[model samples]
Target chain A: MKNLKIDETKYTPEMTFDPETLVIAIKGKSYPENTEEFYKPAFEWLEKNLSDLGKKGLTVNLELIYFNSSSSKALMNFFDMLEESVDNGDNITVNWMYEEDNESILEYGEEFLEDIETLPFNLVPLKSRE
Target chain B: MTDCIFELKNDLNKNGIFFCFSGPISQDLIVEIGDTLKNKMRLEDASKSSMRLVFSIIIEQAQNIIYYSEEKVRPWSAGVNAGSISVGIITVAKKDNSYIITSGNMIKTEHVDKLKEKIEKIKGMGKDELKQYYKSQRKKDPDEDSKGAGLGLIDIARKVSKPLEYNFSSIDETVSFFTVTTVVAEGL
Candidate 1:
């Protein structure tokens, strides 16, 4: 399958799903005009590549600055899909990256981890780039 | 006309309203007004988290109007999926070191009871409960007509420093005017 790379837009995030190194990164703000439509390609790519995952282990990085309620739901669905991979014996790790000073984002990361069973989830804080 | 315009400006200033929009609301307008809100908040020295909270609230409320407002206009477009714009009013104000977000729109009268029940539940929920509810709701499939995950109210509740406030007034036998407000305290 082809790697997925969607450049960031004003109201969406940059999504990079590479099957080669097994590093999936979704970064930037997310409040797309159509949440379901914006996330369609990512979902399709993951569904196609699920079988190829876990051999080398998969790392998912989420570095979102702001996301609307709709995008939040999309993230939950995406994580659910990854958790399913874990159930299939895939070695998957999810790193939720947030700025150090923003406690709200940190709390958000914790919230997303609530339903993630059996996946290696870590909340990683980065220093604010001033 | 000039005096009317001046009076309107004066009223907004008197109420500490920094931003206000009342008309057809679309995705493009949300992006445009959101940028203006951020620039204004930055100039006011809003903290990082506070800015995020304000922006999130604004977007959620605006989208609530966009998705649920009863008053709508179909706009001719070249895209495959035809679009409609909702009509509503959104205002951001400052009072007692707290920022307030207020949104108003019309809703079908039949939906008022259900909306009230949902709002009351959100109003009664503490932060932890709201967070749990938001997560659970996020997991559910969005309704067929829903443009969002149906977690907007809970998400707004989570950010607010107080219980969410709402008002509904009968506009006609078939529709009602609805308004919701959330406040973010100055400190966090």
Candidate 2:
């Protein structure tokens, strides 16, 4: 399958999925008005591609500066999907990146980490942006 | 009317309100408000975390208005296909070393009791309780009538430095005006 790329908007995150390397990166702020609509395409793509995963496994990186509550729910749903895939014996790991000084983001990452089971979810903190 | 503008400005300033917007609210407007507030707070040397909390509260409150406000109007001049926009008021203020966010919207009278009960329960929750509640609610599907995840209020409750404050005023037999306030300490 071809790679999926969505450029970031003022209120949406940049999302890119690479099939060859098995790395999916979602970065930036996400507070789209229609959270479900905004994430529908990515969900569809993952549904179609996750079942055909190779031994290399899939790496998902989520680096969000800020996201509203609805977007938070969407992220939860996204992670739930990944957890389901992991349960089905598909190799999947998630990296949740946040800035060191932004405790709110870190706390959010930690909450998600707590909810997730069986998925390798890591909270990677980047140094404060200059 | 023109002369009252100065009095209005003074009133807002006296109340510590630095930013205020009333009327139609849309997604694009939320982006602009969030960015502008971030920039304004940054200039004041507010910490990154505090700014994030303030911004998140505003987003949640404004979104609630966008989703459930009973007052709406289509910008007829924009075109027939133009979508209707929710009407509400949002304001950000600085007082006692805390940032105060207030949002007001019109809601159907039938929703008042349910909304009040929800906020009341959330207001009674402690920090740890709020966190647990948020996590549990996040896992569930939104209520049938909810347009967004039903977790917005709980999320707001978790970030706030104090319990959420809310009020409802009957506008008529069919509708009421609802307002909610969230406060975040600047240094926290």
Highest lDDT against the true fold, candidate: 2
DockQ, structure candidate 2: 0.84
All candidates: CA RMSD (Å): 1.9, 1.1
lDDT of 1 at A61: 92
For all predicted structures, in order, the TM-scores are 0.94, 0.97
Please write out the lDDT profile of model 2 over residues B131-160, one tens digit for every residue: 999999889998999898898999999888
The list of candidate 1 runs beyond 4 A from truth reads: B75-82, B143-145
Candidate 1 structure lDDT: 0.87
For model 2, chain A alone compared with the true chain A gives a TM-score of 0.96
* Model 1 error, position A120 (Å): 0.9
TM-score (C-alpha) between model 1 and the true structure: 0.94
Q: Kindly state the number of residue pairs that clash in model 2.
A: 0
Please give the range of 10 consecutive residues that has the lowest summed lDDT in model 1 chain A. A47-56
